[model samples]
Target: MEQAAKELFETVEEYFQTREFKQFFHFVDAAIYLAQQIADVAKEIHLLLNKAVAYYQLGDSEVAVKTIRKLQPFERHMTASQRIRYLNTVAAIYHTLDDTAHYYEYLMQAYALATDMNEEIALLFLEGNLGHYYYEMKEYAKSFMHMERCLMYCERLNFEAHEPYIIGRVQYINTSLELGKMAIAEAQFERLEQFPHILTNHHYVLAKGHYYCICGDKQRAYELLAQVIRHDGQHETILSTLYERFLHVAEEVETLEQYVETLETYYHYLGRLKEAQAKKQIDQMKIYLNTELLEEMLWHDPLTKVKNRRYLDEKMPIWLDEQHSFVGLLLFDADHFKQINDCFGHRVGDEVICLMAERARQFFSSESAVVIRYGGDEFVVFYSVKQLEGIEVMLAQFHAHMQQCAFTVKGEVHHVSISIGATVVRANVPIEVLLEEADRALYQSKQQGRNRYTQFQQHA
Candidate 1:
């Protein structure tokens, strides 16, 4: 199954080369199906990521983001390269969404991770992505710097055959043109022509058209650009450039009808572009609402209204992988909860659980920690903190609050107390190890008499 997916991905790459996005999307779907049938998470991540890329390339930014979000739950299964690609793709999608902050944030994350891993191939592509980002931002100097680095990596890695290398060279020429380095642009364009595939690539043709327009060769520019407009008219970006180019070349044309036809086509594409933009906004809003609804239904505890154990399981791997400076894990439960249920009836026991959950939520808040119902009568708090003293103080305040709170059962005043076991550590460790540490401390709390907090101490 994995082999079948791999073969389909290779075909998908060919479809991409031919600019047959619909065919590319179909092959990606086939690969995803194969990956799913085998429960191959790594392959599935790779294929789904490509699917998102196809969506983005086809100008469906909202669906691209929706597809990418579906992979978050499986992120822990991603390989290092896959993770970098995920971040890069996410950054690109955010760029299309006009979210400049997240665009830079995730791009830098991909760069940082690739650098840390010494993944030269990922770095090469990331350099090109950064270059392209700066180019779009009209920061030509910065774009040139990254593009230079990207080309250097391309040479060093012998990656000249790949799309990144080709695109990087194209962007290099575009940046040079923007910076008024006409000589550099000419030299790079000459080098770009050596790639036989560039002859058929609309991007290269568009660049050449722009070059000819700048050089005052209106006839040559019109011919090359006309080809691009004919082949790639569906894309807003391509049409946007063609609109301006055709306007510039309109005066040199033999007949006004030629320019008018191009104008009509551009207006048609603009209308479609606007319609797509509006639909994208609506789709994005729907995705946001559905995401919120899904999380509330899937992650929240029904009775207590806090997060549930499933939520903890989903989040634990992500938190652990982050390798925070200080992590504080706290496990607590209502003392003699079974006895309260047995003696006071399940109804009163239910009230006690609800009251404890309410206090936990109040004390912790969303800012301080993630409070979860690990099981019946058992609650857990995961905290990222600078100091253990802060946790101790919070626990003290939480216990004090519990003491002051009382409820009436059968017209009798009754107080519920909780025993807590906590461990604060500074290293990356498995969740089970942390749980075991907290459990040992909890055992001590129970042994020393309930209604107290115990901190685990690691002996030297």
Candidate 2:
């Protein structure tokens, strides 16, 4: 199945290179089928990413974003290359929607990751995108720097004849023109034109138009720029800038009738751009809300509304690595929880569990701690000693609070007590070791009394 998946992935890449999105999706489906058969989560995520990019290339930005969101849950499972691809694909989708905030967010994320990996090809995509981003942001100097870096990577990787290199050249030329470096821009433009089939590139045409517009060849600039607008006007950023450039030239050097015609076309594209922007705003809002809700659902326990074991499993390593002070791990278990369920039924037992969770949350609310529902009738409180002064006093206060908390069922009052085992360490340690020590302490608490707290102690 792995070999079959690999072949399917290679075929998908071929289709992607050819821009045959339909065929690309077919291979992706086959790869996903094989991935499911083998429970290959990484391959599945990679295939889904390919699907998202294919949809994006087909101009379905909404579907592309949705597709990427579906992979959020398994993002941690992605290998380094898969993660870079995911980031670049997300940036591309956001770029298509003119979502500057999200576009730059993902673009910079990919750039940082690529820089760390020292992956030249990955940097090729990221640098070109950053060049485009700064270009649209009107940071001409920064845009020029990124485009130059992109071309440098292209030359180093022997990708000078590739689309990314071509686009980088075009953007570099346009950015040069923006910075008033007409001589350099003209020189780069002539050099870029030497490449076979470069004359038909939309971006090349746009750059040429900018050149002519700058040289005061108004008629030539109007013709080339207008051609780009007609062909590539669906790209809002490009269309907006091209229209503005074309209008300046038209108003200056064209006849009154020609200028009026240009104004009418410009207004049409302007209206479309506004409508597109409104739609993008709506889509972005929905994506943001949905992503937030999904993250909450993934991380929180539905019953107790605290972090769940999944959250601990995923976030503990990251938190531990970032911890700079002593750490405390406390494990709590409801005493006689099973007996309560057996006597009063599961419903009342559930209510008792909720009551216990609420008390714990309130007691720890003042401390820098995260309460986690580790398993049935078991909770874990992870805290930092730096933020929490006097941990023993806080634990005593919590015990008092739990003692005072009572639950009533069918006019019968019931008191709930909990046993806690805690361990604190001043040095970095494995979570498994902490858990084992805490569990031993918990056993001590259960031996001494069911309704007490025990701290782990090392005997010499």
Top of the candidates by TM-score: 2
Over 367-459, each residue of candidate 2 has an lDDT whose tens digit, in order, gives 477888899889888887764458788677777787765677667888888888988875378888778888998899899978998888732
lDDT of 1 by residue, 1-460 (tens): 5576668768876876676765665456556655554446787787788778877876688889999998998788889999999999999999988999999999999999999999998899889989988998899999999999999999999988877888889999999998999999999988888888687576677678788877888888877767666666656545466557666776576488876776777678889888877886675445433565467668988667688889888877686677567777888888888999999777567667767877877776586578888888888888777765577787687778766545686579988878889888764767787788999998899999999999898422
Clashing pairs in 1: none
Weakest 10 consecutive residues of candidate 1 by summed lDDT: 284-293
What is residue 239's positional error in candidate 2, in angstroms? 6.4
Q: What is the TM-score of candidate 2?
A: 0.53
Q: Deviation in angstroms for 86 in model 2?
A: 1.2
Model 1 regions lying over 4 Å from their true place: 1-51, 54-59, 73-78, 227-240, 251-258, 265-460
